[model samples]
Target: MTAAARLLDDVCHLTAQSLNRLETSEHFRVVKMLGEGSYGKVVLAVHNQSASASVCPGSPMALKFFPRATTSLCSFLREYNLSLRFCTHPSLSRALGIAYLTPSHYVFAQQAGLFGDLYDFIVPEAGVEEDRCQRVVSQLSGALSHLHSLGFVHRDVKPENVFLCDAACRWVKLGDFGMAKARGTKVPEVWYRSPYCTPEAETARGDGDGAGERSEPEEKKRGPRVWASVEPSVDSWALGVLTYAMLTGAHPWPQTSSDCGAYLKYLHWFRTAKSPEEELDLWAEPQHQGPDGTPADFGAKEQPSVAPQFARFTPLGRAFFRLLLNPGPADRGRPEDALGYLGGAWVPVGERERLEERRKKSRGGGGGGAVNEVKLKDGRGLR
Candidate 1:
């Protein structure tokens, strides 16, 4: 059987068994289910049973089940692998490990962050502010900068993938790296709020002054395809949409319930706003006429302007939307450059140090808090 097929069979067989009974590690105990998504199921588990003999250190953890046949398996594995690649970042979630129950079936484990996702937090019910929104955006952009510099693209940059844990979530943690693609490779997943889609270039040439007809491939292979394919800028585009939602609590473009309607709008945005270079010029020369030959408007009383939508943002925020979301890849700011614009101003070392310091204090108190107390007869007891 193919790898995918074999994996599906293994998943079917293993899922039939009592998954709750499976012991991934000696330190944690299976508690109960937490939530389920398109990717898989998340279970709330704790280390209550292993305080005496547990070698693992955390108090409680989350267990994520990734079925082989489901799209979530690939996404889970992708997150597991990429998380390892950028394991040390404080703003990024720590991936514990992966457990392959069967040849094809597996579970990804990680240290759980406190809040669920930004989407649940930033809705009309939550009622956040502009400065707070800017802080979270800065943290995410910083994290994205790190990821992009490491040659990875987070194809999915929606609020659902960003976790907010600490007070006010002045601190931010990025989750769900399943749709991320390597820097140079093309990913095929659909994006909902990305302003920058991949650009497809069509070089048009014809006879000019007796010159022979010449043509070039509109789609370039080495770099980003301008119109047809979505590139890394899609992340920036999504960030813009996110910023808009965070500030105004509404979508930049019209939102629809039907998948078809939503997609039509998405495509329209993709085709119309495919070039970032042009967008930058719009801000640079507001008084100049556009290529379609119409004067750009910045002072229209009824319409929103870049200056105002970006008023509450820092210099970095303005640059992020302008350059990072440049409709074209060439115009869009390089992830590193965009991050450099952020500089050291928005360092994201929120409560991690405080929490760790507290843990040390607690452990220093000589309570039986050290998780390594279980004296295995041998150095290694269970494999």
Candidate 2:
């Protein structure tokens, strides 16, 4: 067997042994199903007793159950280990504990996100507020920076993976590390990745078939070969795509066939000599040509607004997006760069001015207004 196959075999054996021990322990009780995915089911859970007596009991948590039949042991271990390593960060989800439930099952308990994911929170009619968008992206940058500092890159970063702590979305955290990989490592061919993939990743096709589709030798089908170099910039690229989605209610690239067609369009745009802003503006136009010479109306339900919402972004905000969305991976902004931009005057002036005005009113005994501040449970402030 190859090295990776051997390692997977070892993990499977160890997992079986761990589950045997956990079957005798009684530390958690399942409440109800929270969500279900292709590989596993997540459920609301409560700790019966703290992992230690010094800690409190009855704390609510989320238990993600992975069945051996559908989920790979290697991916589960990667997420579990990474979660434990970076849980201290307020913007990253905390993995409280892990336990084996059965020979074919394992469970990981993590901090529950009260509000749903960013994908659900966004609305087409009204895109996310500029201030709120800045806050979410800022926290995500911090999380990505922390992850990079730990020598890892989140291969998948999208709205579905971003979670809110409250209904107001004042505190946001990045979760779901199943696709994360170590920096400088060879990109795994068999990995499951989000559609909001980086250009580098999309272009690194094994067989030159097309972007986003896997091409490998028949013998390598099981484990899949690693063909591309992994880097921290992949995460940055995904963040750029996410930023565009949040600012505008639609995707930056065309959403034609719901397959790799959009990625192909992105590739074409990247090769074009046109400016980034001009390329982005093309999304506002109807892509699908009609049978006649005129532009085809995809119908009111299918068509996004012709006017690009990104025009509303402040000058600095536009610059920030450009920095992140640079077609060249080496040219993309690092997490620290994003943080600096966010802390600087790149954000909308109204947001900072409004916060300052709110502080003044509170100091003058006018009482605090409806101004919202993003703070973590540990008392650390995001902004």
Top candidate by TM-score = 2
lDDT of 2 by residue, 1-383 (tens): 23433443465466545543364137777777776765587787777776543235888787887887767666776577567545567999877745555666767778888676786655432345556777888889889988787777887687767888985667998988877776777644332233354555543344332324444654365344447777888888778767766654446553212255645544443354245445335347446544432234433422232223333344345556666777678888886677655643332344334444544545476442121222221121111
* RMSD of candidates 1 onward, in order: 16.7, 12.3
Report the C-alpha displacement of residue 108, candidate 2, in angstroms.
1.2
Q: Which portions of model 2 show Cα errors greater than 4 Å?
A: 1-27, 53-55, 189-195, 204-226, 255-312, 343-383
> How does each model score on lDDT?
0.49, 0.60
Clashes of 2: 0
Judged by whole-model lDDT over C-alpha atoms, candidate 1 comes out at: 0.49
lDDT of 1 by residue, 1-383 (tens): 22433443455454435333344646457676756765677776765443233225545666767667754444545566566446456677666543444444467566676666676544331124445676776788778877766666676676656676764878888877766665556323222212222222211111121122224542232233222333557577667666655644444333211233543444454354424344434346335533322333423421233333333332233445566545455656654455444332211122223333543554466432112221221111100
Q: Alpha-carbon error at 274 in model 1, in Å?
A: 18
Assess every candidate by TM-score.
0.56, 0.66
Best by lDDT: 2
* Candidate 1: segments with Cα more than 4 A from true spot: 1-21, 24-27, 30-34, 48-58, 71-76, 102-105, 125-127, 187-230, 255-320, 335-383
How accurate locally is residue 120 in candidate 2, as Cα lDDT from 0 to 100? 63
Q: Candidate 1: RMSD over Cα atoms?
A: 16.7
